[model samples]
Target chain A: MPLISQQQKAVILMADDDADDRYLVQVAFEENDIQCELLFVEDGSEVFDFLMGQGKHEEKGSKIPNLILLDLNMPKKDGKQVLQEIKALPAYHHIPVVIFTTSKSPEDVRQLYKMGASSFISKPSSFDKLSEVVRNIGTYWVETTMLP
Target chain B: MRKQTLQFLYASLAAAVLLLLSIGVFTFRSLRSLIEQSDAIAHTNKVLFQTEEVISTMKDAEIGQRGFILTHDSSFLKPYVDATQYLGRQLKLVDSLTNFRPQVVQRQRVRRLFYFAQQRDAHIKQLLAASLEPNRPDYDLRLIALLNRGKATMDSARIVVDSLQQTEKLLLEERIHHKDQLSANTLGLFTLISLLAVLMFSLAFYLLIQEIRRRQNYERQLEKTVSDLLRTNQDLEQFTYVVSHHLQEPLRKLQTFSTRLVQKHAIELGDNARFLMERMGSTANQMQTLMADLLVYTGLGLHGDTTDFEVQDLAVVFQKTVENHEKQLSAAKAMVQFDKQSWPVLGEMEQLELLFSHLLQNSLKFVVENQRPHISVHTFVITGEQMPFATQSQHDERFVKIVFTDNGIGIDMQYQDKVFGLFQRLHTADNYPGTGVGLAVCKRIVKRHNGYIHLAATEVGAAFHIYLPLAN
Candidate 1:
């Protein structure tokens, strides 16, 4: 129940199909001075492989993520399906999932929340604002609250 | 028109048909009775003619008897014998004709007349036999007595025949009068039935034509409505596409590049250059928020799924709204109190949640600078009479009234009407941070649920009253 502490490195897994989005998010976190081990996947399928230690991620072993950031638009599999599959499994349900996408639709936000997303953050267009959003997330999720 | 109206028309048509059938039956019965009365009259007249024939035959027989009594000759006796033969055949014809008369008294009179004729014939024969007797010394007296008896019998027969004729004549007159009256009655009934049938037919035809016109008008109106809806849908789709793609995509690149310029080149650039980049980034960010809010506003204009509606608990919706604004509520030290046992309303849950969230956010955003906001939510059932605006035909429906009263800077009465207008804002961005579409979105959401939302006059902070139909 304690905060994630500066000594313990928190592993954050992010799944996005867009290379630009993945790079911008990494830069945003760096701008915010967030100290965490960030992992990346190109699509929803890779997210699953990373979580279950399957396919190319099998040699990496099962390293449970403290939080997962998912994008709604992806190839092969979408974020909604991955979120549903992750929530349906009792073994992976404890990992906090945050929906990070460009869509600010109320329906998408409501549906993601109903599907057990811990938070819904609209992907900011500006890196400065994205840095602020990332700083806030790190402060709230990593520095302020306990992660399972 | 409607199914019930059509059914009523069919029922009326059936009733009219039944009425016409009954009238036909009645008219036929009346005509038959009239014909029967005419037949009776004709029978009475025939009986009258047969009685006259019998009376005339008796007169001939009396004449022949007198002639034979006076002459005492065979030639005169020949006339008497022919009279007797003709009398038997005439009497038989009279008897058959009289049988057709309706009255028993006429039949009896005919029988008495036949008896008188037979008596007369017997007296004639007696008179002739006496005259033929040559040795009889009292022949003259017997002949004279027989002649007197024959005359008395013929007179009696004439009186009976006269009475029978008089009765037949009276019956004939009575029957004629009855037949005439029946004919007049039947004519009158036929006229009335024809008038009634014509009136019913006219009414039915008029109703059918009116119904057809009404249905045609309804179809035209429906077609117009459908076309208007299609056009509006096309406009909304275009708007959505532009907002999502063309509008946001460029703005996203603008903000991204502005932020990158400020982040990577801030050391090489002067203070003013860095400020411009920062301002560019902030402005792009503001525009993005505006576009997002606009998307939501326009999205509401899109036709919603009608099947998404269900009976939803207002308390649950309120809970979700509170949870969504938890951070803001805690930061402002705001308190939102409401009855836990709120009434259930018929609506889409997500839309209702958004509606409540906007209202709650309004209260949170428009508070006094140093004061903690206190928002009290009250719910109760209300009739149409309690509504501030005019209600048409929904007066009988029960509405769940939800009132959100806050202890913040209240809106002026003049601006209350404009608060729900799209993109209408009373405060500057520096004073209050909002896209000025929160209340408008709430209004759209409420309207989607067939409900109403309005700003009630308040002395302290803002008060919003939302009226939603209670689930029956």
Candidate 2:
């Protein structure tokens, strides 16, 4: 019942195919002075590897991320596929998944929400805007919404 | 051209049908009259033959009487008896045949002839009895007197019969002449009818060929237009997708890098480099905004998925859109008043929302300085015929016209034509901050909904009339 504090580290997993987008998001969090531990994955496959401890991830029973930030477009598997896999599996179904993508199309937003996305955020262009979005997402999901 | 051809075709068809129908009725009447005339001619022939029969029977009776008087034979007397028996029946036959009102003179002659024949028959009988008593001295005298009387009677009867035959012959000639006249008139009418028919048929055939040719040309033209529209739609979809996806990626990076450069190294950058970076960042942001607006404008018409359409209440759509703009509206102190809120229309709900959203934003952006913006939207139900501009000729079709009036800076009359154009900006970016694609998007949205958005003439503030199909 206790709210996530600044001192306590909350791990947030982020996935995007674009390296610059991933780096900018990391820089946005850093510039905004948010203390949440931000983790980055390059593509969809890397997201699964970090989550399921499969393929090159030989370790089992890894620490589950408090939240997942997904991108729509990626190599090997897409955000749609990962969202479906995470929602379908009972073990990871409790984790809140937010879709962060450059596609702000109504169809995509509507479809991702239907597929049980916790939130849908269109990636902003400027760093200042990205920092603003990053700070809000941290305040709402990490500080306000109770984790399962 | 097609309409004219169709009208001509229908006209020619009607003329042909009328001519044929008239010819049918006329021909039926003429044939009936001809049949009646032929029957009359047959009746006249029967009357003539019956009169000749009566005269022949009388002659036979007289001939038998003379034979018996000369030879004094009983066998010759047998012919006289047979003739007398047949004579009365033959007279009755002639009388019945000439009984019509038109044969009054013939009937009189027939009666006189029957009387004379009866007198001759009585004289013949007297001669027969005289021949039986050859020894009596006065017998010869009686016989001579009787023969002379019978001769006179037979002559009178022959004259009457001749006169009757002559009258009947005249009547027959008149009937034949009348029949000839009828035949001649009928032939002329038939000739005229046939000529008219041929002329009408040729006219109809010409119109038919013209109609077929016109329809073929129209079909070819319609097919071409449809394919051209399809090709244009495909190209537009491809362009919108490419600009929204591939084009925005680099611009996003450009803006992010400039912002990150400023955020990380704010102290070390020179003034000119910082200014260049700021312009570069702002320009990239503008490019992103332009691309995004262009995508929306281009994408509105690309939703050919007609199944997405549903009965949308414009009032509800407007209310939801205004709620979405609540922060901006309150911040700008904008007032939106509605005279009607239950305006129902058939459209895609999201697109309708988008349409009103752009218009609401337009009213908010174009507000005059130091004035609170007041926007009022009213709706009216109107028939297609009552549409201010031309549309489909479904005169009974109904539309919901949403009139949006705003107490904002209205467009100049001279720039009205350019207001809704894509990428058209009436004011500089410094004065009015907009991409100028908002109105274009609104127009395209209206078109997608089988509706229209037109700028109405207003004296005080901008007035927009948005027409949509009224959902039942």
Candidate 3:
């Protein structure tokens, strides 16, 4: 088990097909005071590639993300398939995968959790609430939980 | 209603069948008895005819013997001999026919006739013999005496025969009367059976027509209900699609631009400008939450399919729900106690999880000031009859009763009825932070699972009771 050190910044890999949502989430993260490396992917397949150190992610070296933020509705492949694939692999199963989507549907949240998602957070429409949510996620997952 | 109609139809059909069967049996018996009575009357008439024939044949024999005595002709003797033979056979026949009757007077009269007939024949024979003997000097006188004696015997025999004939005639008349009575009774019975059958058939037909009309009424009602459901579903689908796609996108952009403006021009803007920006951001957030909840509410209406449901363990679903609300639970310092023995219910796993999550969220949100929320989830099995608001036609015989109780600010009795309504809130946003659709979503989910959920009146805190079908 690989433990994240307090001094080191954790990397959060995000997969979302929406450009505006990705940019807004990045801005929300910037507005918050959480110190973490943010990596973005436009599709679910890219999420798998980043996790496996394949394609464009190969040049970045063997740097696995400490956490994965997934979007439910993505082009090429959906977040549900990615979550299933990530949880099925023994090497990546221990990494926390949080579903961050615009869907506040309880069924989607429950389904993501049942599929081994670590957390499900609905994307807030406002920037301030989004920043607060990102800050809370950082505090809970990074500072409070002992991530492997 | 349909079941009741079908039961009534079956009952009437059975009654009609039974009535027809009884009528058939009764008519058959009556007709058979009538035929038997007619046969008895015919037999009695035959006996009367034979009795008269016996009397006439004896008289003929006596006449032929007298003829022979007067003319001294053997041809007359031949006729007498033939008549006597015929008379003997006829008397035997009459005796045989009368033997089966229980009438003692008839038997006695027949016996007297037989004896007198024998005496008449003897006298005739004696007269013939005396005439034939030429040596006898007083043959004519002897012949006359024999003739007179024969006549007296013949008269006695005729009188006996007449009595026998009278008895036979009376028997024949009585038999005819009995036959007529039997025929009339058979006809009456047949008429009664026909009338009863007609009445029963008419009653059955009337009941059948009523049942058909009732069924048609039910069909019409069902068609109206189905059409109304279809229209509502279509409207919900359109609403959900619009809310999720068209409505939320602009709201998201509003929040994004407002935050960017505050971030880039915080120094350039006045102090109140930041406050206004923050308010705008929160308002957008609130609207987004409301829209999301509305979308979920509308999505629940698309529950026409139930094939996706399976036997799911409540414990697992509860665990997922607790996990979903982990942030709030920890923030509120809520303690949730669940039973160890899991209940298996027939439902969609995701929907059940959502339902419990909403209940837990409500418990956490409605806590009294400065108090840690305490929520307990327990389950038991109950019959449909035990539920207060269950429909009589509920298909499930037994249900798993899941009770969720919390030590939170209780709902007033007056507000309990309106709590499950969409967007209905008992408290302001300052007291509790929610979209007010949590309970409504729970109710919708329960309904989708063919279950019942309601708030139980409590003095201390809110309690919700959910009744779901137990898996077979």
Best of the candidates, TM-score: 2
Residue pairs that clash (backbone atoms under 3 angstroms), model 2? none
Candidate 3 DockQ vs. native: 0.36
Query: Candidate 1 versus the native: TM-score?
Result: 0.59
Tens digits of per-residue lDDT, candidate 2, A1-148, equal 3277666678899988888888888877887776578887788888878887776565643557899999888888999999999999899998899999888889888999999999999888878889899999878877787765
Evaluated with DockQ, which candidate comes out highest?
Answer: 2
RMSD of 2: 6.7
Candidate 2 lDDT, tens digit per residue, B1-472? 6688778778877887888898999999999999999998998888788878877888887777778778876687676778788888888888887776475777788889878987887777777888888899888888888788888998898899888888878989999999999999999998898788778878889989877787899999999999999999789787776767778877888888888898779889978889988888888878888988877777676777766788887778888899999999999988889864687787888888888898899999988889999999999888888886646575678988889989899988777668889999999999989899988888888878878788888987899998887888
Question: Least lDDT summed over 10 consecutive residues: which range in candidate 3 chain B?
Answer: B241-250
Off by over 4 Å in 2: A1-13, A23-42, A49-67, A128-148, B1-48, B59-235, B238-242, B262-269, B299-357, B377-387, B390-403, B445-451, B467-472
Q: What's the TM for model 2?
A: 0.70
- For model 2, what is the error of residue B4's alpha carbon versus the real structure, in angstroms, after optimal superposition? 12
CAPRI band for model 1: acceptable
Worst 10 residues of 3 chain A by lDDT: A1-10
The total number of steric clashes, by the backbone 3 Å criterion, in model 2 comes to 0
Return the top candidate by lDDT.
Answer: 2
Q: After TM-score superposition, what is the CA distance of residue B64 in candidate 1 from its true location, in Å? A: 14
For residues A1-148, write the lDDT of model 1, one tens digit per residue.
3266667888899999877777878887887777678899999889878988988899997778999999888889999999999999999999999999877777788899999999999877877778788999888877787788
Which of 2 and 3 is the better model by DockQ? 2
